[model samples]
Target: MADNTSRIVYEMTISHAEFFRTLPAVMGALPYVVDGSEVSALQDTRRLKINLSPEGRRNFGPIPLPVTHVELGFDGYSHEETQAFL
Candidate 1:
């Protein structure tokens, strides 16, 4: 398995309105993990560069992989469940 422990994490936030509007688009961007603590409704101005080792490339695909639009899929969650959680 590829080693993913060396990845750089950048935490950011946006308005609740903007987040909702962009959530679908964001979900299609890349391979990432979402943590409860990482959710917020305020803007955070911070950025970081990611340096991927060979193993990271194998795990995450190419460094500049193009993302095609994908329909959002919410598995096993009702509308109310998703709204309440968000």
Candidate 2:
């Protein structure tokens, strides 16, 4: 693992409701530290929520409709090793 901390930033478009619904599955695919947080929102909508977990665990309900896009941000160490893993 590299000493430097890095962040993974990406964008996705999804409905407000759908975003909340799939939050858990999305977060599960990410490599967060033991304790981490996730901040989410809808495009152009004022609705937003921030969830924090000391164990880096996230739980989101099922989304009925499709999510348009989503913006994902992750921060952690092992910056150099990440590329090889990907």
Candidate 3:
């Protein structure tokens, strides 16, 4: 029998702190990203621009200051699995 699964590369932008916090939760909730796809890949790149002003500092604080971008690739995910994941 031949496999009928498809691959997808999902990308999203979020806060640095939010990403770290959600990472584990997403993993626990769904193992697709964590379990590893046929050629699963992940990339995290922190925003280069940083606000040094007092207001910026006060609003975002220290830990959650920068913006983070994530890219994930999932291979061999079935239609039902993808639907459930979404």
List TM-score per model, in order. 0.23, 0.33, 0.39
Judge candidate 2 at residue 72 and give its lDDT: 33
Residues 1-86, candidate 2: write the lDDT tens digits.
Answer: 33443444333334455545666665464433322245643323222334432222123456343323332332333545445332
- The local distance difference test score of each candidate is 0.31, 0.39, 0.36
Model 2 spans > 4 angstroms off: 29-71, 80-86
Rank candidates, lDDT, best first. Answer: 2, 3, 1
The better-scoring model by lDDT among 2 and 3 is 2
True-structure RMSD, every candidate: 15.2, 13.0, 11.3
**lDDT for residue 45 in candidate 2, whole number 0-100:** 20
Q: How accurate is candidate 3 locally (lDDT)?
A: 0.36
Q: Let me know the TM-score candidate 2 reaches against the reference structure.
A: 0.33
- What's the true lDDT of residue 43 in model 3? 23
lDDT of 3 by residue, 1-86 (tens): 12334444333435445554566555553333322212132223211111111112223544544433343333444456545555
Top candidate by lDDT: 2
RMSD (Cα, Å) of candidate 3? 11.3
